[model samples]
Target chain A: MNQIAQEVQHQTHTRLSEVSTEDLIVDIHGLKKYYGDVKAVDGIDLQIPRGTIFGFLGPNGAGKTTTISALITLAKPTAGSGTVVGFDLHDRNNIKKHIGAVFQEQTLDEELTGLQNLKFHAEMYFLPKPVAEQRIEDLTKMVGIHDRLSDKVMNYSGGMRRRLEIARGLMTDPEILFLDEPTIGLDPQSRANILQKIKEMNEEKGLTIFITTHDMEEAESLCDQVCIIDQGKIIVQGTVDELKNSLGNDFVIINFNSPDEMNLAMNLLNDLPEVNEVKSSGSVLHIGTKSGSTAVVKILNTLKEKVEVNSVEIKKPTLNDVFLYYTGKELRDDVADLSDRLKMVGRKKGRRGMMRRR
Target chain B: MYASTSKSQDSYNGFGIFTFIRSIWTVYKRQNARLINSKSQLISIMIMPLLWLVIIGQSFNNLLGSSNPLFSGNVNYITYMTPGIFVMITMFSSLFGIISLFYDRDSGYLKNYLLAPISNTAIIFGYAMGIYTRVFIQVLLILVIAIAIGANIPITVGSLTAIILFPVVVSFFLSGLAITLASRASNVETFQAIIMPISMPLMFLSPILYPIKALPDYLQWIAQINPLSMGVEGLRFVLLGKIYTDGAIIDIAQFNDHLAIFNFALLFLVGIVFLIMGSKTFLNSLYK
Candidate 1:
């Protein structure tokens, strides 16, 4: 009895240590942010692994910006604490060295040329002049802005400016980078170009990237893991495949010849212990189970006595289905009209009338 | 793939103080490049102060007659107003430094510095130094114009050194105040609204256009308490070699005590206090 108790205590300690030492590059625990009456980030916990692209998905006013801002030291977290690259967020100066951020809004100096802007950023990071020049050259080329290095940023296109901003964030040679809605209002070509560059940076440079977006397709394509947040809480989080697989096993969809056949198939499959859910849509039958092959065999063998089955197909779950299951709402349901969303993003950017204001 | 080069580079042998000063110098160089690169604006900025010295100085010459014993004893009105106007121009140019903070905040360029690995105090000092350099240049240009316009300006080395140091201190003071205001302000409109009232009252209350002793007793008390008034008086005392009086008209019998040592010390003490207060406000505003 004494030996058993000691073994149990040792096992518990080892398990607790394993849980605490998870491969989390950014560990946020019970983070709560309040803006007067609004709890912008309400008791949220997140863990992102090193060298993985983590996507934060949420709609507007869902605390995505606030959370990112707090992580990057642009805003202070009101309650709990977190560490980025082993430095506390409250130690902003130390954490800044390890993290680079591209804000939702542009922060480049239009009066300066693209090269000059990068140089300015490099100097701010205390990079020596020669190293800064070389890094600037490499980054501008990486972002495909090398040709326009000498051109004033004011003369560049919107896509060009966005690219420059991303390249500027790399001047510090940070271990982790945060991109907040990086491609919110860009044209498809520009968005694709930016996304490709981000991918190359992560793959080639081994940089950890934290991307926040409302676009499900972007998250599914770029992220190694996706965390869906709603009303300031993370509803679910997992890799794209893991999240989809968590929903259920393969669904064998059968379209019968008649409604009576579908009803007959459902009645037969419902009694089988292997079949989890059997629902009929008109003449169609959807049989969800742990084993698709075995369930199909049973359904067909039993259907031989009832009615003829015209066609059957098995479909795996998708990110869309996973999102729908977790949030109980379609991903694109609240997506603003294209032009209206563009206008809203543009307003937040505040780049159009900057020169006039100065 | 290029393997990582983990070899540490030797620390360069350079004067640390010189490197720090050079950093500030480079920033000033960029500021000058930015200012001079805009040809029309640069020309207008230089011409505006010269034009003000000529036009406004001439118009206010008669209105600002030497009825006061302080001016009648030594120099003409233009000579008397030259140092005062120089200090006023310094104050105005320093106020324009507010726009730099505003532009940085709006463009998110300020965040670039805030997010840098450097100390927050360094960021504050760098910006303050940049604004101070610009105001000093403007002050220099105004002094040149004043000299050319037959405004009897002192050319002593002591006065020149004082003029240079005056702007440095005043700019540091103003930049600290500007950073505090800019940090709390969400937009340019609210910033302008708050600064305008503060700037106007400070100008009126300070001894910029007239001697402080010329005001009523109650107004004198207000001016005595105003920080800008102390700054103006200190600048005058330093540049014109004028004795500072504490709201009392100078008479021959009272000449020994006419120059109040207490008021001179008060002015210097207030300037130091404002600088400390401004820096404290700046650091507090950083997190907000």
Candidate 2:
């Protein structure tokens, strides 16, 4: 009995040590939030592992911001709880010490110089002046804003302000950083620069980033794992390659001699059990199935026996298709519509109220 | 690698009470810097009140003169109006505290403070202290002008202490009220709508321009109940050696002792309650 107990204890210790290495930096369980009658976030469960770049993708009104707000202790969750860096979200005072956030809006003081802005934040986190100064210098250099540190933020361009905002988020040297649509309205070059800095932060410092965006290209290039949410619920989540592979084998598209021949080709190709979906548009017959090369060779050989084949192409699935397959709609469709109502209603109500009061 | 680890460890020495206090002090210093930087605005804020003291005080002299019977032995209207004007300055300065808060919230700068590791209590107290500092300077300037204009304030040190404490107490009272209003305000318009009624009524009902005893029983009850009345009366007792009475002139010496203790306790309790409620509301409204 003594010998058996000793062996079990050794195994448990080894397992515990391994588990510590894989501990999640952010663990959210069954979190929910409601805005009056609208359920903004309904029961979201997510686990972001330490030292990984995680992207949260969702269409408008999909509760992405609500989830981020809950995680950062900005908004209270109506149900369930989440932990950031092993600190409870409900216990805001403790959780605030470990997490840094850049909000959707520009949260910096526009009237203050960049250096002063950083200094104020640093002081709030209680870093000594010398330490904060050094960190600020390093952060400015990292974000490529070191040259404009003395200029007031009001004088800076949108891109410059965003870069400074990112640097401000890093002032506390957080283990987990949350960036909500960090590159929303920037020009292409500025967006690319900001994305590169985020990548470098993850690579060099081993920092865990939880970034939310609807930009498919950004998630494909930057995130190690991506979760797609729609209608206040997470539909699917996995690495980019895993999600794409889950769509099932590659596809082969063959352009026929005529539009009439395309339907005939699709009809013939449907007989093959390996073929998943065969769609014909105009003179093109698009076939999605396993073993693309073999299917293409067989289809070409069969087509030669009947009609002519003009061109053949094989392409891999992309993140765009993955998004469409999960959400049943294009990601970009009517996203700005959510904010459009707010702009119209908020302004009209505000104006009418003001006039009546006056 | 060594440098990086050291930096990371240093960053984790998170904020405590002392650090929070230091941060508030830094914010207070910055507010003063901005006030001083705007030379014209600073001069105007100081001059406008002195202007009121001279012009309005002189214009209302007949209405406030001893022939009115309410004035009795106190003939000078400037001295009578000085404390009221001082209270007005205090009201204006404290009201700025809430306006600054609303501006910060609208412009999104408040988000940075909200996300910081500091506690909500720290933010409320810091802002209150900062506003009180401005009120302190304004009160001092008014005191100097009052002395120069022949409004006699007792030269004794105890009387000076009471005069100074008067503004601080009024500041605490108004700061609490301002923060409470600021926390509930969704926008500047909403805030203005809410504060105007409260501030206007409180100003008129208080014993600022007139002594409480001169009013009828019902109005006298309202004036006596007003928090501003306690402050204005306390200031009068300290400066002019006057006693507050409802029917007859009470002993000046005994009235001073009673008013001092009562005002101090009331202001302190109100300040604490306002700070707690304001902080709680402010934290809840942070994300919404």
Candidate 3:
């Protein structure tokens, strides 16, 4: 854990202790997952309270999937241990029975109809006939795919497929719902719809959701608490605001038309006394500082003197900034690139979206 | 409403054999559902055996003449080749077991099975059942062909009843073997690459096309251990009322010398062994 996360952990520990250990839906201490010489999930300690949406934000190959796999008992930890839904990590059968998951990889049989997929799951989890049918109907209705339940999953749109998967994941009425990048490929409208349904599920049913994603804005909007991991270790773990405040660095996002112009603006802004960090993502150059509002005028004026600034927005420190700060510029680029490719992969084939821990 | 969000009084305690069987049945049912969508594939599967039976049976009979030793005691080339073709169909149809496994694993559907609260044994059993059910259907089609050809098959109730089990035995063992190979295979192409060399060699080397005694000494050694030969000889004995040999036919009767029972037991043992091995390897790969 980094200094900032450690501080947050220490602060949350007192309140967590008072709530009772039973309420700790996820409890991990020094969990490690190694593949040959590669340490996929290095030693990490963390805890998640019940009924909260916990977001795992990280760069590609940073071990977010590995951690989720370990917790879900899909992959064993090489060292250390944890408990999920009150079951030991090694007790995979116990853990599996209590949790539901929509993996980053597609897990549904495309040839089977939506109803058949749910029915298959319902049977595996030992849901009674009437109850299984009832739950399937309820889930389809809730996800708003009740009309297309008979259609083959291969025929369903990306958004509908995601909804079915989510419905199927909840067939057993799990204690913890694991959504590993639930909206990777869907259009903005579909993504927003799924996000809305997720919020409603959280509010109405009080389900604890564990999500892993590279989408910073989505994490900011949906996550109650977020953990940022890089290179198999947690760099920061706290609520959204806590992570942003811990950075104590705001940013001035200045969009420019050309790389040459952004480069000139970057060089000019870095020379300023108030600007702490300057990094460019495509045409947008982000300048970080102690106070973004105070530095905005100087940055705008300096950039205006050299190159035309398209737009200027001074904003609070975001999850993206936290990721850039903690995971390194190169690693964060890898994640951003991965997210772009994953969108295509998730749409093209159900092979795998999340890169395997390397 | 998401039941996962709303706490329900019904909770998981643990599952037992009944649930395990249900899980297996669900896989079996799901596979059946998938198979139903590809109706044309069924015709293609049946065509291989018909072509083999008609082409090989016809050409060999004419070339070798009707006086061949295999045709002795009312057993003609068609009768002799029927069982061999059935064995061929058995091996061919059972390949869907591995093919489906590769498809599921590659396409990520296996994750759903692994994540479920079911035993590894159930998954293997379910897969074997699913594949063999389709194999059984194909076997029935071949049986219809065998009957339509009027190959002088024994028409007794006992013989008819006994013959049905031969294909089932062949299918069970072969499907189990296919599943075992699939667990080790990384992808569909790899599975096919591995399967072709082993399956084809075993089929050609086995006494499926000729009497075991007719094989050369070196080839005979292979035939002795070959499961397909066991199925061919077993099916030949029960269905044709005679077992072809290098010298003469042995009358297939309980009193005279029925080898079908022995072959049946051996096939059972092989099936069990393969099922156990396949399930173990499959379960190991489940989380990997």
Candidate 4:
């Protein structure tokens, strides 16, 4: 019994030391990247704990990719001091060996087979031949690409290519993996598959993952911590529940046939003491409240005589509502219309900043 | 199954000289693999020199007899132009290999190299050396074709060594220029638009097709400073036992040995300069 206890204690100590005493895998203070007159990634601070999925959530042109590029040493920061895996930002080689990256764009060699691509990356990280071969086999199996490893990457489907890239990213068995829009062009099924593989990698290997995405559902479901960023700055950072509860615990969604009715409903809902926040996009009205049951009762009573409700939903708060609550604009890919819509939203509220950090 | 942290760290070492050479070797392998896999491209590259030897060499030989005022040696027209074709092969093979760079960039594959823990110098060296290897093979093929076609080239050890070593210097120079040009080009179209015109001028103004004397006096100066001309003349000196001097073809015995050494030295100097510049440009693009 004593020998068993000592063995268990030694195993625990070995695992803890292997993982490292440093809790933060990525810690950056005042990171910035600029392109001529444009401030692509304005000053921002981030701390990501090890063995967690931390999401940088933003819209298009929101500097999420730029920030990732800076952190990965693909782009040098304009002014900042930071460490990745306890090494300084300028110590790129050390940091690179410790981290893996799946870029927003496809970075796989189309001319090479999937196995060749993985081997090339393995060589870059200086993996021993046998170790590289074993890891390649293991990682391909984990990512469900074991069958396709012999095929050229060009012949792989879009989802298959993403899976191969994910496997390549893990060739080095990095402590932290940085994925920039890992599922941008993939189909819904592929996205789900990729997300599942990412989760498996994290859980099985105890890997820290930093993912940059504009996907609300992805961030909400996959991330342990998330930061909403816009215009090169982080608007807010917290866990999904913390961000959702910051706005409110419950939400009431209403869709109207006409913008006039939605505006009327918005005005009435804004006057309610039970409503924490109200926003309208097109003919839809979203209301944030403490109690979905009570708010729905008050909302129905207030809108009964004045406005005709098309459809209504009472639900818990999501990252979507949290984003709208803070940004005052909907999360969208159309950057051209985003600024114009933002201006109109700002004008409607008579507020200076469309999105403000709390 | 993953190893524990201590074992993993012991297994992976991103620093030190071995990893540096390993990174370069990996990049070099990728380039050669791509080169070998593209059958159509290889066929085209191999056929280009033969076409030049057949059409151009045959037409010039038939148009001008075996003996002409342009011929300062006992060599025939085909023999006279063979060295030029060899240098041209080196130039074309070197420049053509850079198209892969543009392709890699457009396909976003270059980002993988950039994100690797390797230094930029290793990437540049590995890529340049890969092109040199390609040029070496093409030059060897040209040598065989030149000899088979009855070009009166000497089969001396010194001449063969020159043939092997000179293309490396020429490729070093041309690939450097090509990569420097490619670094600033936004896409393949822009790169081709700029490179085609530059390569055409280099081909015409050099001593590849004709002796420097064949050009007008004003153009001779351009040919004089042209690295391609220097490369061709230097190869012509060792291969045909003749070198062009002051717009006149002369026997290698009459040519100043210092001038011959200067020609190679200048090519080496220019190659080193452009390679350094190209590396800087490539690094700038990464940071930017």
List TM-score per model, in order.
0.79, 0.84, 0.86, 0.85
Question: Candidate 1, which CAPRI tier?
Answer: acceptable
Winner by TM-score = 3
Best by DockQ, which number? 4
Highest lDDT scorer: 4
Ordered by lDDT, highest first, the candidates read 4, 3, 2, 1
Task: Please tell me what DockQ candidate 3 reaches.
Answer: 0.45
Clashes of each: 0, 0, 1, 0
| Distance from true location, Cα of B1 in model 3, Å | 7.2
Candidate 2: residue B257 lDDT (0-100): 65
Contacts from the true interface found in each model, as a fraction, amount to 0.43, 0.46, 0.63, 0.66
Between prediction 1 and prediction 2, which has the larger TM-score?
Answer: 2
The alpha-carbon root-mean-square deviation between model 3 and the true structure, to one decimal in Å, is: 5.5
lDDT of each: 0.70, 0.76, 0.77, 0.79
Off by over 4 Å in 1: A1-23, A249-317, A331-358, B1-41, B65-74, B181-183, B213-217, B242-288
Error of 2 at B18 (Å): 3.1
lDDT of 2 by residue, B1-288 (tens): 114534543443446666667767766655665466455657767886688667776667656664565445533656676778788788877865556666667667777778876667777777777787777777778778877876655568976776677777788778778777767787777777777777886887776776666667887777768888778767776666642343233223356566667877788788768876887787557765
Worst 10 residues of 2 chain A by lDDT: A1-10
lDDT of 4 by residue, B228-263 (tens): 887887788766654334324542335555766788
